[model samples]
Target: MASATVDSGGIGRASLFLASGTIVSRILGFVKLIVLAGMIGAYGDSADAFSIANQLPNTVYVIVAGGILTAVLVPQIVRASQHADGGTAYINKLLTLALLILTITTVVAVALAPLITGFIGLNLSSDQLALAIAFAYWCLPQMFFYGLYTLLGEVLNARKSFGPFTWVPVLNNVVAIAGLVVFAIMFGADPTGSRSAGEVTPAMVAVLAGSATLGVVAQALVLFYFWRRIGLRFRPDFHFRGVGLRATGRMAGWTFGMLLLTTGAGIAETQVATLATGQASVFVLATAWLIFMLPHSVITVSVATAYFTRMSEHAALAKFDLVKTDASSAIRGTTLLIVLASAVIAVCAYPFAAVFVSPFDQIVGIGNVILAFIVGLVPFCVLFVLQRTFYALGDTRTPFFFTLFQVVLILLGVLGCTQLPVEWIAVGIAGVITVSGVLQAALAAVLLRRRLGGLDGRRMLQSLVKYLTAAILPVLLGLSLVWLLGGTQQGGFAVSGRFGAIVSMIAVGLVMASSYFGMLLLMRSAELQAFLTPLRARLRR
Candidate 1:
């Protein structure tokens, strides 16, 4: 495998491209969620029903798009590039095999909608199950399209053409949002979550779930143009002689196990969450998870994704030291921002929830859940880098062991959560999740350190200590400002109205950002410069 030369700032510029698209895509994503919440109340049974069903596509898709594609495809494609045909026949065969799997999976999943719905939403009442099953039928097809998008888009990344992969999600959001608007006009709003399963019509499901599915279709199909530009032609190559599933399965075996473990934990969480249905349960958990992922997606994901290619290149050349350096830098660099973002999100949680749901108790419910999830931001980000680093090193077995360990702990803890009072159940589950994340990260660090003989652990620890110190003043100031606006109190200035929440959140966030960055600058934090150095080098270039 050939290693491409990419200077420091080059990765930073690449991150900028990724982050810019993520920012827009996330904004639209939030918009879509807000609309969905308005359509069905955030804590309502109807909301839980839809959220539960809707999650199936994403859960199945993550197992495919997020896990297997990266685990198997990119390296496979990169290796195939050595052939005289430039990997065309290999890619076509691989693509055909991939689509075939996705198609079968989608069909089977749709056929088993009721059982799948029951598995995740374990405690849903009969009515909720009925409605969720209906939505599942329409939404399950997204598994195929998401896999398509991942297949086409990841090949582009392997080819060093990365723009379309990031940009296409904006279209998905736009299309979904438009469909939501039409659904509102036809079906009317149900912000109170009072819409019963019986009230749901075929038209309602079509406009709602159908729009969501169509968005993914658009996202996947749009990649064909980019594929053509990269000099690839589409053909349904059914000849699967040398390109056999056994080989691919062998390669993806550990990752597939990791995926099942990860989803098992999620199913446990979702089932436990269902116990709090019509309270601060399923829908709130989903919303809070979405919000929790925002900073990670924008900062950690963007930065690490940029660094992954470089690390893989180094790993391919057997440059373990450079791979170690990239992984270390990614963890530290992302954490420097993550700690501050965590502070802001913690302080602004109520107002943030107010952006989506209107009820004061519901706003507080989401806020509490966010606080619970935000506690593990650092560890979560750390684990992300380590997992991707393992992938880059072509070792999925380690991730599986660590992931298996965490999922077991999480399942045990979730079992404990069922005993909590209803109001506290969601928070308990979130806390369990956060704790598992922290422990998993520590385990992953030890393993990677052993494998690489040390991942600059001492320096990384010092950076973490310095970042925690820098975040203290910002967190304090953010808390003080939030208290002033009564962010936690129902009918208070920040939570009284959406506009007020927006204004208060922006004000407090700015103050926190200024104080946090200023403290980092005064401390002469090298971790902070990890991000800046790249952009500065890129600008000069």
Candidate 2:
């Protein structure tokens, strides 16, 4: 049963499809990580150095063109196309501004990468430092290409054409992988090739690095073609030049401020990991992150696309009631999905972790220890979905403020926890991150309700109760089945002997998911209807 409140915007549908696309992208991204980790190994100082060295350049790209650009540009493009009356002209102005900013930023980033790397001194070996430097130079072109692609993607999204945007990463990964493959082939043929994979031969590293940058170029070109197909013209309009920069600058301030705070939180986590003995902290953090992002990729990113689209439409219509209803539905759907995903992760943590680190288990150890913190990832998933929903509503500042507060809490908690002599600082850091996320989500939810003129709190609570009932039964049954089948021990259950465990897990998951939907539908929960309708249609085939 749908809610009594009307939803004029197709938020529910958009979220579902968006999440599906995100899942595809995230899976490819995951595969990329696995391959990279296998190649780089896990525990060595060289790998550590590579991670740290790439961090700044990656940060520069994300802040200047990736996150900040996506967060700010999407809404503006939505407004300009949908409601600003100037329409195509407005979009052209936005694109021009984006180009100008990207050009300046890329030039600046390339110049700064070396000086910053030297100053930070991430304790890389001479070879590692050189590779890092090469990687930085290779990453520069991405700033320009990503900015263009992001603008085009945002335009497609605003026009409610998500199919093309969703597959853009497929193009990116294919190009990137091809480049890497070619670079490896070239390197392996070189006379100096036998000098260890980790040894950064300038020629080899430069080839790999340069190829990476070229991949981004390839990505942008594909997206540009799609943009043209969708009726976008690449006009370098200087019409709004002077004033446009100023407006963009103003928005950039807010965008960068939020990014800076979030980046600080990331840095804080890294620093804490650094304090731990060996790479245990990094391994755990990375493993937990991989698990955590699965749900986020599915739930949050999916919901964000729908939310952003609906909010843009609703803002145009001044349909506050519809806006509120759509927002509530997005939250409800995202929350329920996360709960389900958390249950799945909890059950499958060991197997999933094993697969992730299979090729490099020696370097990182068996990854099961990171499962301790996987539970804490539930709230983090919820927070990510909620934050994206808020941002989509053009209320980005609210999340910024809440994230700042959360970071404060994290800093204090981590600072205090480190003094306690825990062996796995990653676990302690996980606790802090979890706590911070929950706090932020709680605060944001309150603000969101206020913004929406109060959500159906009692109704939402009742739905949550039904969901909890549906979720718990399957989890318990699955756990019991796993325990009887030799538990989640790595060596105890051979894949041959443990077919029962796999079968039982599948059975339990299906049963639980079905039961959860049944309960929600029986309770007349709008969220259940929103989710199950599409699934039911697919199942009908």
Candidate 3:
């Protein structure tokens, strides 16, 4: 039997599920942005209004919505499922509490929207401000439903019912896209004809807001349907007097602490970025954020989903060896993924810039300059996966402390970068942050290893060498391709028109992916075999 491992069973299955969901969500999110960009156009008061209003609600979403969904609720569901609770009671109680919290938060948010926009969004015009308030109200209400949806998802994941969970985000994105199309029709045009009346007012920024609300409603309904199909039944239990209250309070307390730290660091980064001279430079920062977050979305969340489930499975079966092996595999897998991605990005970076940067030049001329810094962070970004490893071992404080330290380093780095030219500032910050990330990961690995007690260090190091060797070949090939293809000259891949950058990026991405795969095959790395075996099984299916 080769000693059945968590990697071979539920956790692996759940990870693939979450990964697939994330891919779907990311693709749809990309589409949604494209639609939004076309509808709003670039560089105007409307765009500014949408951006500011959206950020306000999103910040709340992250702090409140995401805090519970990822940290508190998911862990609780996993624990409940481990003891053969099958998730019903835990799901009901968590959802009930989440609804209560979300409703209260939404009310407070709506009332305070104007105040928030006034303080944080001081740059917007009157129309922009009105739109922001409307959008905030529309989207704010979703916090309640999504809180329940998140609970359902966590329960499904804990139950190893990942297929359902995976499809939910895709469904959510679909609704969002649909709403965008309708909003465009209703709003009439960017100048105001495209507005659909009740669909979303073009004159109001709430069109974007309405789309978000509709999407959440649709997503929540679908999740609820699936929850029912999965045999989950819930009754409201609002009394916070005993076990439920204690559990909810503890989870919320932990999650809020963690969320505050994370959100505070993000806010600091933005503040520092804003202090830079050029206005367009902020777009550069935003674009960098968009690009880096693609991988962060796919890798970090997928691994966390897997880690949490695997930990529960191991605890249930009393299979310590399997647990350790699965944990080690996860660490190695995520680390290699980060390394390979960084290498590829670093190698073909200039070509990618030529293919993707020019179009955004109108809003951001220093796009290519920022791309370098974005690539620089890839090395450190892998450490994000370390948080999953810690969480799996029932530790979260390590991540909190490590994150705080990194934030301090980032603040210092940004302050130092301001002394340099604007062009170098982004790069300098990226370099400092990346290096700090590496240090953080090293320290985390040390601490985690000591706490958990076993991690195939010797094999891990050997695998790293093999992985690096395999990665080097493609990087070399990619560099040659870029050099041969004009190497950052004015317009080798064509920079004009609506589809030029899109086509070029697609072509380059495909070539890079193919070449990287071929190189891995030639090396016959063990990691390649692991990926292939699972894929082969899926093919048989």
TM-score of each: 0.95, 0.83, 0.83
**lDDT, residue 448, model 3:** 67
Root-mean-square deviation of every model: 2.7, 5.1, 4.9
Relative to the unseen true structure, what is the C-alpha lDDT of residue 267 in candidate 1, on a scale of 0 to 100?
A: 86
- Tens digits of per-residue lDDT, candidate 1, 212-244, equal 999999999999998887677889899877644
**How does each model score on lDDT?**
0.86, 0.62, 0.60
Lowest lDDT 10-residue stretch of candidate 2: 1-10
For residues 1-541, could you state the per-residue lDDT of candidate 2 as single tens digits?
0111113446666665666666777777666555455445444443444455546655666666667666666656656654455467777777886789889988887888786555444444466556567666666667787777777877777766775666667666666566556755664432211233356666765665565567667767777776667667778877885334455456667767877777767766666665552445554466567667777777776676657667656755677776666656655667777777777666755545544443233212323444555565555655665565565566667777887898899888777756745355666777777767777878877887887777666766676676676777667765665555544554444112224335544665676667656666667776777666877998998
TM-score of model 2 (CA atoms): 0.83
TM-score of 3: 0.83
Off by over 4 Å in 1: 1-9, 64-66, 241-247, 533-541
Better of 2 and 3 by lDDT: 2
Instruction: Residues 139-196, candidate 3: write the lDDT tens digits.
Output: 6677666766676776766665666555666777787788778767865445311322
Better of 1 and 2 by lDDT: 1
